[model samples]
Target: MYLFLNGEILHKEEAKISPFDHGFLYGMGLFETMRTYSGHPFLLNDHLERLQLGLDTFNIDLDLQKLDISGMIASLSEKNGLQDSYIRLNISAGEGEIGLRTTPYNHPNILLLQKELPPLMPLREKEAVLLKLRRNTPETSVRLKSHHYFNNIAAKREAGDDPGKEGLFLTKEGYIAEGVTSNIFWISDGKLYTPSLETGVLNGITREYIMELAGTLGIPSEAGMYMPESLLKSDEAFFTNSVQEIIPIHTFEGRTFPGKRGRIAQQLYSHYERDAQVLFSKNELHRS
Candidate 1:
C-alpha cells in the first residue's frame, strides 16, 4: 500500500516520523477517520472542515487548500485498487526536541493512510452493551479528536469482558455521552434523543448527517443531557458512526430489549442507505 506523507507518496514500510515530534511526545495532534464508497470518499468537505476547525482551535497554521486532498485521495485509492476502504488523515506537531514548548515545531506532519475496512458486526440487528467506565470530565479535554486515546482504549479493554458489541460511555454526572468511537441515540415516545455537544461529546460527522437525515425523514430528534434511566426506559436505542452508519442496540449491559432492531433505527438506517446511494451518484457525476 502507498501512504501520503506531506506531498509525497511513499511505500507503507517507508513511512516514518521522528520520535521527538511533539505529537508523539505530548500527544498534540488531531485526526479524522473517513471511509470511501465505490472508491470515492464520503463527505470529504465535512471531514476537512472539521479538521480545519481542530487546527484553528489548536492555533495550527496549515494551508489545507493548497494540498489538493481530493486528487491525492483519488490517486491513492486507484493505486491501491481500493473499492471500499478506510482513510486515516492525521496532522501532528512536527519534529521537536524534548521540551514542553511548541515553538520548536516548524512544519506539521501530515499522514494519510488507506487500509482495508475492518469487519464490522452485521447491523442486520442492533446490539449494545453498557460500559462501567464514565467518560472524561467536561474539563478533561474530550472535545478534540486528539491522539490521546488511552482513556477510550482503557474503557474498551474493560468493556471487552462484556457480551455487547459496543460500549456506552456515561458522563461523570451519569448522563449518556457517547460510545467509545460513535454517538449514542435512543428513541422514546416516538422521539429520538441523544447527548448534547455541551456534555463534552465529540461532534461526530456521521452524527450530524444522521440528525439532518432524521429531520428530513420527519423523525423527531433532539440533543440534550440524558440519564441512563431514560435510555433504559426508551423504546429503542442505536449508535452512529461513519462506518457503522446506524446500528440498533439489542441490549444494554445485561438488560435485553424486546427486539434486536428498533423501529426508528430501522427507518433511519433505510434513509441513511438511500443517502449513500445519492452521494455515490453525485460523486460519479462529478468525475464524469
Candidate 2:
C-alpha cells in the first residue's frame, strides 16, 4: 500500500505524525473515508467539499488548490495496483506546544492513505439489530466530522451481544437518528421514512443519494422525527453509509420485523448499485 503524507508519497511504515499535535492530544482533527471503482474515486468533489467545510469550521486552512488530490489518488492507485480501494484522508493541527494553545507551527499534518478494500458484508440479504443508544443532536457537533467518535465506539461494544448486522441509534428524544456510523431509513405502506436532519444526524452522503434515487424511482420518501414505535409500522428498514451502501435491518432488540429482506429494500439496493455504476462511468470518462 502507498500512503501520501503531507504531499509526499511513502511506504506506510515511513509515514508518521507528532505526538504533541493537537489532533493527537485533543482529537481535534477531521477525516473522510472514500472508495474507488475501476481505479477512479467515487464522489471526489463531494468529499472534498465536505473536507473544506470541516477545515473552515475548525479554522485550519490548507493549500488544497495546489494539492492535485485527484491526480494524487490516481497515481497512488496505479502505484499500489489498487483497482478497488479504500481511501482515508485526514488533516490535523500540527505539532503544538504542551498546553491547549496553538503555537507557531507552519506545517499541519496531512495523511492520505489508500489500502486494499475490505470484504463488504454480502448484500443478497439485509439484516441488522437495534441497540439502546441515542444520538447527539446538531447543537452538539453536527457540522464537523471530528475525531471524537468514542460514543459510537462505546455503542458498538455494547451492541456486540446481538447477532444481527448493524446497530441503530435513537435520538435522545426517542426518535430514530442513525446507525452507529450510517443513516437510518424505513419503508411503510410504500412510503420511505428517514429521520430528518433536525434530529441531529450526520447528513451522510449516501443518505442524500438515497433520497434522490428514491424520488427518481417513484418511491415516496420523507424525512422527519421517527420513534421506535414507528418500526412496527414499517414494512422494511435499512441503513445507509458510503461504504456499506444500504443494508437491511432484521431485528430490533430480539423482535423480528417484516421485510427483513423485503421487496422495497431489494429495489432500493438495485437502484443504488445502478447509481454506483454511473459514478464509475463518470470517473472513467474523466480519466480518459
Candidate 3:
C-alpha cells in the first residue's frame, strides 16, 4: 500500500511524522473521509470546504488551493492499483513545543491515505441499539472532525464487535444524537427527521447533502431535538456518512422496518447514485 505525505507518494511503511507535532502530542488535527467514483471524488469540493473550516478552527494554516487534490488522489490510486477506494485526507499541526500554545500553526503536515473498496452498494441494513454511553459535548462550540475520537471509540466498545449492529447515541440529556459512526435519520408519516446540531452532533457533509436531496425530492425534512420514543413513531430509519452513504435500518428497539425495501430509502439512494454517475460522466467528457 502507498499513501501521499507532504506532496510525495511513499509506501505506507516508509511514511513518517514528527513525534512532537501538536497533532500527535495534543490531537490537533482534522481529517476528511470521502470516496471516489470512476476516478472522480464524490463531493470533493464539499469535503474540502468543510476541511478548510476545520483548519481555520484549529489555527492550522494551510492553503488548499495550492494543492492539486484531484491529481494526487488519481496518482495515489494508480500507484496502489485501486479504483472506487476510500480516501482519508488529513492535515495536522506540525511540530510544536511540549505545551499548548494559542499561536497559529505555520507548518502543517498533510497526508492522504487510500484503501480499496467494492463498488458502491445501497440499502445495506443494520440493527441499531441505543448505547449506554451518551454522546460527549464537543470541545468547541461547533463540532469539527478532529483527532479527538476516544468518545466514539468507547461507544463502539459498548456497542461490541457485531458488524451487523450499530449503536445509537443520545445527548447527555437523552435526546437522539447520532449513530456511533454515522448520523441518524427516520421517517414518520412521510416526513424525514434527524437530530439537530444543537444536540452536539458533527454537521456531517453527507448529513447536509441528505437534507438537500430530501428537499430536492420534495420530502419534508426536519432536524431538532427529539426523544428515543421518536423512533417508535417512525416507520423507516437510516444512517448517513460519506463512506457508507445511506444505510437503511431494518430494526430498531424491536420494531421492524422495511429496511432496503423502504420506499423513501430506495428513492433517496437511487438519486444519490445517479448524482455520482452524473459527475463521473462529466469528468469523462472533460477528459475527452
lDDT values, one for every candidate = 0.77, 0.73, 0.89
Name the Cα RMSD for model 1: 3.6
Model 3 CA deviation exceeding 4 Å by range: 278-288
lDDT by residue (1-288, candidate 3, tens digit) is 999999999999999999999999999999999888776688787788889999989998888978899899999989998888999999999999899889999999999999987778756999998999999999989999999999999999999999788999999999999999999899999999999999999988788888877876799999999999998779899999989989999988888989989899999898788666444222222232
Better of 1 and 2 by TM-score: 1
Q: Candidate 2 has which clashing residue pairs, if any?
A: 128-250
Measured with C-alpha atoms, the lDDT of residue 58 in candidate 1 is 62
Error of 2 at 75 (Å): 1.6
Inter-residue clash pairs, candidate 1? 126-248, 130-253
Tell me how many residue pairs clash in candidate 1.
2
Per-model TM values vs. the true structure? 0.89, 0.87, 0.95
Clashes of each: 2, 1, 0
lDDT assessment of candidate 2: 0.73
1-288: candidate 2 lDDT, tens digit per residue: 678888788998898888988888987788888777666676676677778777666667675656788888888888898867888889887787777664333567888888887434355334555567666554355546778787788888966754446677887888877888788888889999998888888877777777877776788999998787887667788787777667777666555655436788888776555555445322233232
Q: How does residue 226 of candidate 2 score in lDDT?
A: 74
* Model 1: per-residue Cα lDDT over 166-242, one tens digit each: 88788888888998888988888989889999889898888887777677668888999888888888888888888
> Which one wins on TM-score?
3
Q: Give the TM-score comparing model 1 with the true structure, all chains together.
A: 0.89
